[model samples]
Target: MFTLSEPLASVIARLKAPAQQGQIGRLRRGIEKEGLRVDPAGRIAQTPHPHALGSKLTHPHVTTDYSEALLEYITPVYCKPHDALAFLGDLHRFSYHYLGEELIWPASMPARLNGNASVPIADYGSSNIGTMKHVYRKGLDVRYGRIMQAIAGVHYNVSLPDDLWPLLREIDPQASDTAASSDADYRSSRYFGLIRHFRRNSWLLMYLFGASPAIDRSFLDGKPAPDWLEAHGSDTLLSPYATTLRMSGLGYQNKVQEQLKICFNSLSNYVGTLRHAISTPWPPYQALGVNQGDTWQQLNANILQIENEYYSDIRPKRVTRHNETPSQALEARGVEYIEVRCLDLNPLLPLGVDAAQMYFLDTFLMWCLLSDSPWIPDDECDHLDDNRRLVVERGRDPAMRLNIGGELRSVPERGHEIFTELEAVAELLDILEEGSPHSDAVRGLAPLLDDPSLTPSGRVMARLKETQQSFAEVMLALAREQAEQFRREPMDAAHRALLDELIETSHRQQGEIEAGDEERFGAFLEGYFTRAREPRAARAV
Candidate 1:
């Protein structure tokens, strides 16, 4: 079984393992003195808030994004260059789960805007939560006001190759001198990181849809809107920045297409997806020598000034620039790696995932790649979008239809086809990892596909409605289980500390950003998008 440990010891140990002995000693002693609880509820609950923030009862707008985002990004399973996903192994047998943090914003505020201050959040908020911060279930659109720290999901990732680093900047770097001395900002660096991930790892998904209101409701005991409903559950409350599209009104073909056009307006898209057949970059552009020197820095500064001037959030503000960049990992060839985005925070399993779940995910991904989906046709491009909604709202409904081969077919039947294709994938992984999670994870998908109740999102909605508890309550129960898991399983030093630090910093950042101030809001949108463009330390360094 995979090892799990308390954040205090586990996380630090992992990050510091390669550090000097003195640093390691300092880290260990700090842990001993601080005494990692991993018991957030015990600690967090005790730290009472007069405001009583966070809720399982997500806001209408929040639910709206949840519903729509899922439709755009989720897929049944991603595989190829990402076959490692299938190698997952046995989940902790349904036991006392050690749920991680529940990233949330203050309950009183509208979920639309994030506050500058870190409030007491649960999971991964850009607040502390048990999950990954980058995996926010919500959209990180710059137009959405300031950047809110939350769990990132399928929407905020990319996968590509190492060689794609030099071509990340929207404009050339030869004009800027500081570009040499100062580190490449995260936006440029990580953009390349994303490219490498997509190029090298390849991804697959179970559903194309992301978090949806209807899907969230489906999981509840209460009846929700049927799966057939096609609409953005979010209200028409547009961000002030929505005007960037010059939308006279939200036109279907025009606006959607417009958004798509702008979103893909980057160098990489034309180079990669458009040129999948080529071995090297297309019609190769000359590389800006890394040592272009001081001239490049001056040019970059001028570019930064221009970006700051025109780029504002939904709310306008005086120019306040962010010092955005990635944490360095170049020493080890950068931290560009796969981000597992589709998995929901399983209420049934603690640690937000299981052996079977992980295994299934891995195998499913293998099948996803091996199934050999063609370069998606323009017409079929929306299939991934369709799957997101299906999985979120109607994931468990037997009648749910998913788009496959350009057709909307019921979840079960289509799932059977998908799983059938996956059998080979599972076998491959079984061979590679030798009885790893991939086999079990792939094998388990059919049951989830066939039995709606078995799905994580479905179970959450069910528990909330039938038990008549708030989403908060549902999460609390899960958290309790997860906490127990944390206690029982004993996390490694790195993982545990990562979790704890994420929680603490999440909270701290929540305090800073949740105020939803103009500067904070701008930061959220700009920072997220900016980071999206940059390179990870490995390639650039």
Candidate 2:
């Protein structure tokens, strides 16, 4: 069995006190899940985002992601995982009423495609902010193509209790004077520490929850598959031991972003790196031109149009105010929460995620926070990425070995070591809670470490082999099944009423914003980027 580090053990011991343990109960979490809209025939839907779903630009809950067909569901923060999930379910049920004949695509990989043109970019309306949103997406289409924009996934947002910060500061002796400068600084630093540890250990999450092991051949768009991806059925390409091909090079992974070294060691470094990327021009993008006559071809010729373009498995976030950028919010205040961006949508699960998985996530995130995390050096960051790619491509392989702190360790061995620590964290979280649910969740998923077949990816591959169905065919059937189930279920009366009100209100709000816009699009665009480029410290002042 793996033993906990002295720092982790010491913190766990301190957290065992009733007062410190009570703070754990105050954790808040939310979910933002995205799914593509496909027709009954399982092809990408050509229709616009349904009108009854409310304004994609103004709706607080439902919105379009990269494409009009990619529906994103946002849940309000809830203290309990089940409450958040309940809200997400209500959102799904509410959406189905307006969906007509379209079904929410159940998988992370896109449904059948007819090249890049089939995926329509989302149009947020003519308001300056909405126009900027649309143009940024248009830039994405020019740079990466619309096909990649259709891929969907879940983003798990979470924040530790406010009361937990002081305790964390007290427990970590090496938190340093920099973190000791202010409460915001200390909390931000600690969150970055959590992010560092998370980045290092995130491969474990891929092994446990990754569900996209196969994709329909249509996703390839006539391109040949790599030698490593073997043919599954006639219409599918798969990696036998791969966990999340969605996270692999084939999906959201970008070649240009590979060169970016965003620092998670501190909030300032993080902001600096992002700002530099957005400010620096890239030749390839510059060649595309920012505009053609009156039409905006792209947002800018920079390496990134905005901070959001530089994607990562995780992000340090603070809620932005009106007309503020994400970085501005973080700098003006501090990291309010961290967003887990790497989770795949399990087609088998109606919500793409489940309660037990939520409990496990809570346990895992808490473990990351309480662990002894050191700053990752340049070489270590590259190593972390390599480990993640290895797991993404061939995680379920029994013979697979991963680099753990510079040593080669078998997947099971390293996983077990991590779980040992996770169990201790789960225990602290489960205090005052009924039935040790968090600890139970950790123990429940522990078996997947030893038994690959129990994993979502493993199960998916197994089903495909047993049924001899194409990836698209299997997912289409599952989508239909899930849609029927949602239709049969009764939505909460209170939630149903609230959604009805919001749909109407959101439409009005979108119109008001558009009508109120006085500045030209060109001027608005310039001002937005100018504010984004201003010194974050100045903005904070």
Candidate 3:
């Protein structure tokens, strides 16, 4: 049996006590789900972003990710997970209303792509910032190609309350500090610790929730299918034991990134490493150049066009101010929350995700923070990568083994060990919520562990087998069904009104930005890169 450390056990005990029942209130959470807009025939939409949805640049809630067809919906942070999910549902309802004949593809892997030309990079009006955003996507097209960029997923942003950290510090005397100035740094450091632990165990998430075991053949372009993948139909390729091909090399995998050894040991190391990548030039990107005859191809010929390009399963995030880079925000304000980037869009759900999943994530993340996370050595980090690949590619294999701290253990055995700890955390959360929702969610995952066939990936494969449908056909059918369901449901009046107001305001804001640009585009780009390279404290000085 796995044992919780003394400090974590005591924290769990105190939180579960009756006296502390209502003290925690609720942890703050936010959701960002991305889906590709497809026509009734299920092909990627070639149409521009619908004007009714507001400017993809200025809109706070709605935006385009990499391709214009990829719609990203973001919810404001909420104390209650239900409220956060409700907001996401509302966004979907509003989006469906303006989609006309199009449907939001329910899965993370994209719909059929004719080729690179068929995938349109998102265009964000004429402002410098807008152009910067567009040009960055162009750079991605140049580096990674559009098909890989079109794969979409959900990002779950979560943070515990400020008070909870003080309580945590009290429990750990070594982490305790008397100065207010140091509080933010302490919180940031602790979040990094949480990140370290999350990377080590995130394979469990891929196994349980991963839903993309197969993909449309068009997603592979003209490349030959790997030997392990079998043709599901004339137009689709399926992986027998694979969980999330979206998390696999088929999606967001870059060879250049493999060399980046970004350290999560501390905030400084993490920032320094990413900053170095942004400034460092690479031969492949350099050959592409920043522009091809007057057309901007990318922002720079560096290893990274920006920090957002460095794809990872999780990220230490801080909400950025207008015109600020992500690294700048982290350096100035510290890490406010962490974003879980590995979750596949469960095509089975109308909202792409649900309250039960959110509850499980909350419990799981808290468990990660409470657990003892040792510093991951460079070699162990490589092993961590191996573990993720194994899970995503062959997780359902009963005999699959993973290296945990230099020891080999079966996937089921390791998963059970983690679940045992998660259950205890869930009970503590249930105590905090004055209900059993958290515990219920944890118990819900038990059947999946016992019977691998019950997992989302298993269900996806089973649906394909039973129906004899291609990946696109199955996902498109679900997409059309979900669209109809959303269309039939009336939007809440308050949410409808709020969305309408945001649409009008964002359009006006984008116009103002276009009108107010005084600096030349070239100068603006140069200045932005220069400022991004400077240390935050030095820039302030």
Candidate 4:
């Protein structure tokens, strides 16, 4: 029988009490979607960023990721999921107006990359920080091929209110004891606990929502394709039972990263290990060197050029202040929120993700936070890695078995167990919201497990088969369709005005930053690395 942990059961009961039902509006969320700018021929566009969009470095809403062509849209934090998605739609509408004949590719896996030189690294202007950003991308091109960096996805950021934690601590006496620490420290510790549990159950999310089961052949970049992947045409590859090839070894895989053992058992250990990596030089990267003549190729020969290079399915995050590193910000302010990084762009949706997915995420994360999360030993961490690889590669295979607590369980059976627990959490959410959105979203997953063909990956594959089209062809069609839909729907006048103002403001901001620099680029780089190596100290309240 599936059973909830004692603390979870008690919290649920208290949350369902008559007095607390309508007070659950404290969950805040934000969304970030990355899309590649592509030409009408379905190739990644080599054109410079559109002038109307302003500077990629200073733009508040729209910015570039690794490639200048990869545009990332960020929404302001919002209490209601619908409002956040609506803001995303507005950003898209504004983008389409300036795209001319170009279009934003609608899939998580990117359009074709002809070669290394074809992908342009983003330029942020003449400031030292701006140059550092460009050099980091150059280092990525050296370490991992630019082709791998081109893959795009959606990130969902979420945080619970301060009021909810005290209630949780009251129900769990063990948590109450930790109240001796400052609220910031307590919250950071609890958020790390949440992260550990999220890692254990994250595979279930891949099974439910993973959509990138196929990709264009050119993404392979002339390398031999894996045996399990079948060619659909001269230009496309398909996987029969794959869920998210985007998360597979073929996607963001880096052989060198395997050596770094990053632990999430506590905030101190997590920060300590990452600090070591940033300082420790790697032999392979050292051979590449930091610069060739006057041109800077990378920041340093360290294992990671910066903290952002360490990619994972989810991350504990704190918003950084000006000139602060990610680690510095975390040590100072604690975990303000978490960024869920594994979601693929559901090409069928105009905003990449919809409200139903958002509701499901909230329930799933709550389950992760409230569940009994034991400390993961080294061997179990290896097992967790294996399980994630299995699901991302072949999750839809009915006979596939996963390692759950040393017991082998069929994927569907395990999925059923997870959903059963999730449904209970969904009911609690429904009681909190005075409606059934969360409950209805949980119930909707039932058909997906019973009939694999109903899953997002299944639906994508089915469409490919029925249309007799390559991945690129199908994705391009969807992109055009979505573009037309956004073009026809009237954009909010206020949002249009906001976009214009932001573009002008970003341009001025970039100019100001470039002109205000006093330190030489070399001295600035030295100072930044020096600060990164400093011991962790809590910021004064």
Candidate 5:
């Protein structure tokens, strides 16, 4: 019953050609997953990063995030989603061999925290680059507190095949009219369009995949719980109908960032806004000071320490070269891919996500790209944020309604309309496959729109109710269970050997980097900011 936009319908018709199938099958994706390391009692581990796991500063695959206890695993890009997941699974298995009794916390929320001080900031080493990383984290410690930095989630990185660009450009109305539509310009514009559409509709992802509905009382430190939250047990706080508290105000929200209206209509606009934020000083951060005596406090007194500090649900990305900032990379080579940063860890799965979910994500992302997306103005941006907040806090409410185009509509009704379009995209993708896996993934998850209990967050809440266990207790049990299963499964001998070699090489690389540094830290810091402050011209397509 859903009506496809004229642009979308035209693209689908063209994509059905025999010559386009190969390009469609060439999509690539990668995953970056973060998990907190905790002891058997579910307390955040106070130990330094395990030595056998390799140097966090130089390791390509294994590293630390905001805290030493927060382990981040990265996988290289793969054509098939399952292959990427297999690599992720191997990382977990290899780490378990050296983790001893420690377990990786399974949920998006942090494990039982002692306080802000208990969350140790990550230490990278003595190199200038290492020092910069550590100092940047300290800035986050002062800006948002270490407790919020301890929250973990999954980041999915994906890129359409290069060969598909010419096909899209041929179909683009604007490109057809323009005389100078370079490959770089067209790709970036299409990515921004995809991002705009994603910003407007990513709430659907939270409703389906969000898993952090409850948290341990200790997560708030000594602060009182908000009225919206109800006590689930002596030590657990929850919102009965919430989907992802990890994405709500209770989690990573910052008042200062809320004021930053970062534009996504064009690549230059995005770069310019980010540069202004990093270069402009804020009063509160200025009070903290960049240096105290000989000890470094932060990178600067700006609104953001770096581009990475500016958080968004989705981001246009380009892999940066050595010493080049992210914006510089985009200005030089345009967007290479996009990263989806709003997904919560599904504690029900050992890897937090599965093949079926990845298939659905691929379908949904394609639908966003194919849909007709207009540039979003500031007022409309605010409305999108409001919609996301509503779904995050009260998504499972039976009578919840969303303000779609100023008209109020029930969640199920809107969800079904979107899914109908998704089903069409799925069929297009499944053209060359033996089974309709992509279409099957879309159809299988469609029922969750009407049945809230079938959602991950709902399943977690049901577990808490049936077991009468606190949030920490339930998560710890899952962690232990998953850890045992990982240990029992045999890792590929070749993969294990590769990991072993990487551990030694990572340590050596860090040592060489520290020894090779001759530039003063202050000079390097100044040069870094100078490069970031360079003016960017509007690169609109």
Candidate 6:
């Protein structure tokens, strides 16, 4: 059992702790002496550039060496040599979009999203490939803005040991972890392993969520859109997170189609609560207002319902357009982690991450996990559907509340708990990292919380407010600043030369594939898929 040992009490103590003077002063002085533009709340301002809205949007899983990375993480590498699926560039989408839901019917949707990439492509017509954005970027300020936080992602799933499968569902929860646990429930050998396995192979485990909404061209706003992509692109997205033949049966090749069908039914039971935007009066057809019949105000009455029954982390609604913006669940059959689908990368960072901030996220996720993450009870899941509407349009208002624990709690309290727990996690990371740079970095989150005016989101809001610029303007400014910094740190010379060599090798491989070198390519894909499909075999190798 891999216990999460960072004790809660010890870490919580740091919530009120102030930043160390040495680092704080140096940070302040660095900004002051350099005349760096700090926002009203004392954070560096974003600079302007061509892709100024998006600094280099290099996400982690997307940045690894393709074959080596697959070997290291997923195992097995099948598909075409230029197989975009086998590449790490695409797989990062899954890691990027760690939220607990999927983006449905993007085929006719045209959206302008500044994701975890360098430039905010002005118009991303209908392709959903590599479209998932993590709740926040990997190591940075990725938490959703105030209103969005309440819509938490959770999984109300039951698990079974390899042997207990058919009989697992009727099992008791007092025997499981969620509510009123039974003695055998927590100790059940299948519990955490199911979760760990889900977490590890999450991208591949797309259970058919529900009927995807119709694609709406009107969502495009006059932009030229591309052809529609596969509904659940993250499942097949390029990046180190992808699935190859080797990765099969770790989750794939299950002959138990009925077991999978049961999983779909379970998921459908939850999704049933959400009616389409057209059918629901709550969404109010582009008007952010109140009405009856399961309105947001009603939904907010129980924040937990929003968090558990309705919210997601990955593939959030696109900011620029509304077509295909409706919630979607692919029709499939399987059991897996819920997908969260909303996150926009802050354009001003590198790798879209930082160390100290990661502690904030770690604690936040733990809170989501430790607190009551429930399944959509048979009665409540549907009445609380229109969460994204409230978030995108009315998220910043602190007065707003949403359902949680079957009742509404102020969003601030939710934020506090998460942030507070994060500070504590920082303390633990400091201890773990010891004297490493990561230790000092972990403590830096306090400063971020103390001065929310300084975070990337905060800064963007401030800049937009101060300059009275469109979101696009704020984006350009940040992009330029990040680009300037990235440009200065050009690829190392040795790395560039090595890249040149790899390119030549790659060109030769291409020729082999072009010559229909079936034996060679087939051998490679087979070996790779087999190795990937069998994790134990790869590890043994």
Worst window of 10 by summed lDDT in candidate 1: 26-35
Writing each residue's lDDT as its tens digit, candidate 4 over 90-165 gives 9999999899989999899999779877788888889988898998899999888788888899999999776777
Per model, state how many residue pairs clash. Answer: 166, 0, 0, 0, 0, 69
TM-scores of the candidates in the order shown = 0.43, 0.98, 0.97, 0.97, 0.98, 0.39
Per-residue alpha-carbon lDDT of model 6 for 1-541, expressed as tens digits? 2223353352233321322321111000000000112222212222221121111112111121111011111212221212222232222222222211211101101112222231111221111211111111110112111111111111111111222221232343333444453323232222332322223212211111110111122222234433321222211111111111111221112231212111111222323333221123322222332224421222221111121223232211111112211222111212222232322222334323233333333333333332223333323432232222222322333455545446665434444444454444445334423353333443554344334344444454455457754433344455445434444444435434443454345445434434543343224323432332221100110
Please provide, for model 3 over 278-299, each residue's C-alpha lDDT reduced to its tens digit, 9 standing for 90 to 100.
Answer: 9999998898888755579899
How does model 1 score by TM-score? 0.43
Error of 6 at 155 (Å): 19
Q: Report lDDT per candidate.
A: 0.30, 0.90, 0.88, 0.86, 0.90, 0.26
lDDT, residue 160, candidate 3: 81
The TM-score between candidate 6 and the true structure equals 0.39
- Over 110-188, each residue of candidate 1 has an lDDT whose tens digit, in order, gives 1221132221232323322211122232111222211222222222122322322232222233316436532333333
Q: Which wins on lDDT, candidate 4 or candidate 6?
A: 4
Clashing pairs in 5: none
Q: For model 5, how does the per-residue alpha-carbon lDDT over 71-113 read when each residue is reduced to its tens digit?
A: 9999989988888999999999999999999999999999999
Prediction 3 global C-alpha lDDT: 0.88
Q: TM-score for candidate 3, please give it.
A: 0.97
Candidate 4 weakest ten by summed lDDT = 17-26
C-alpha RMSD of each candidate structure in angstroms: 16.9, 1.4, 2.0, 1.5, 1.7, 19.0
**Candidate 1 residue spans exceeding 4 A from truth:** 1-142, 145-258, 262-267, 270-337, 484-541
* Cα lDDT over the full model 2: 0.90
Model 4: CA > 4 A from native: 1-6, 18-24
